[model samples]
Target: MGRGTGPSMGLMNDLGSKACEAWLSEHGEGLPWGQVVAHPCPNGWELRHVADAGRDAAGLQALPPGALREWADTADDGLFRPLKSAPTLRRGWRCLVSSHDDLELALGGVYPGGLGDWWAVRTGQGGPTSFREFMGRQTGVYRGVRGLADEAARAVVRACCHAGSCIKDRRWAVEGMVDGEPGGHGSIPCLEPCALVLEAARTMARMASAERTSVALSGEDLAVLRAALERASALRPPPGTREAELSAPDNPRRMKLLLEWLGPEWARPAASPQE
Candidate 1:
């Protein structure tokens, strides 16, 4: 699908460019944003994936501003990246921009409205949508998400919005909780829930509504399950696994939620706060 090109989008683009330029001037060179690192080169600026920040530019794929969208469309394994802010951005690419407009275009191609979101948060003009607000606005397939138990809802958010999955700092919170910490300068801010998170919430809501069948397992069995899930979560997803397919039992976020539900013994702190 094509991106919005209306007047509002143009204004956002301009604002994003202005904010980015100001940030660069204040922070100077070599500051990293999300998975990207930017540097002031002799001509203009050089941007590359954080993984390739230390590599020689001549060795990486040189892409123009216009090609960044295509370059960011897939992962190194050729999987379609459903979330642009996902930590799975492919490395080995470098982009050069001679002007702020070019930099805006290039960054937009890489992170979509990332700079604009950052600007909104920095300027206090926009903020995150709370879990309650996000659910209240849902319709059709996602409308039932409002019925999910509050704790269950928080678990879903924690699982899906975990830094392991996406890099955007979540400012939204479940009801009764305040906004998340505004991170240090240059961090990308998530102002609202994304479609993927909504999908996960929907999946969780459906699971919550399902009939409960008790299957007793010993502590050892539960331990084994936690170990297996922890191992899986740390490894690369299977080639056939779809990262955004929450209904699939093997999806990473689902595993994370399951881990959260299981209350893994290893996850507990050895030293209590009272200590």
Candidate 2:
């Protein structure tokens, strides 16, 4: 796909360039100091928004003055307008897939499979009809293998350490094996999706370490984890599982198990405290 040539092109380019730099400094080199700014670019905000914002933001103040106007004038309206539409989702997906390929070229193919590849397969097979459908179809795959790995990894970490806390609390855990490295050793906590889990684990681990208590993976917790694994394993295309089944039930067994694993001190009553 061609780049949008709208008046916002220069502004977008400038923003993209800054974003790339920020991403690289933070993620690539582990820099300790850098300022990164992000603003929502809603569909209604046209080239003027980009130009105006660029002028206002300190980081973008250095941008060539005429670049924004020139970009707007030369940019193709048809290309620029469609980019503001919902179709941009697919376009963004494709860009991600391509970027992965580029990374593989430079970094020796670290990722085993591209998300776009899996998405393509799911969409082509007539799985879920939309992005929502795609998420439902694939979340199971993540929960099953990746989820199990995460659970097992945490369990093992707790078992081996003095903390006795679930690994989920100590570090971020990821679903896929990197470069065939097993037992989730190479996983980093900063990446997306898994990052949230890693943060939770880190918090738990810190708490356990501070309290001088070990994480206890009781039989009930294991059962709950296993059930989650089972649900993940049983997942199929959207139509395969009724929407009603996806909704959380009141007093879910999983919730009870999780609370139990956290211990009574951590558990709270379902209702809020009175004022």
Model 2 agreement with the true structure over 123-153: per-residue lDDT tens digits: 3531213211222344432332222334443
Q: Which 10 residues in a row give candidate 1 its minimum summed lDDT?
A: 1-10
TM-score of each: 0.85, 0.20
Model 1 ranges off by over 4 Å: 1-17, 26-28, 176-186, 264-275
lDDT of 1 by residue, 1-275 (tens): 01122222343456655675665664336767778888777667788888898898789999999899998888888878889988888888898876666767888898898877877877888888877888888898788987777777777776667666788877777764435522222377887888888887888887777888886877567667677888887655578888788777877777777776554364443454574
Candidates' lDDT values, in order? 0.74, 0.27
TM-score winner among the candidates?
1
Best by lDDT: 1
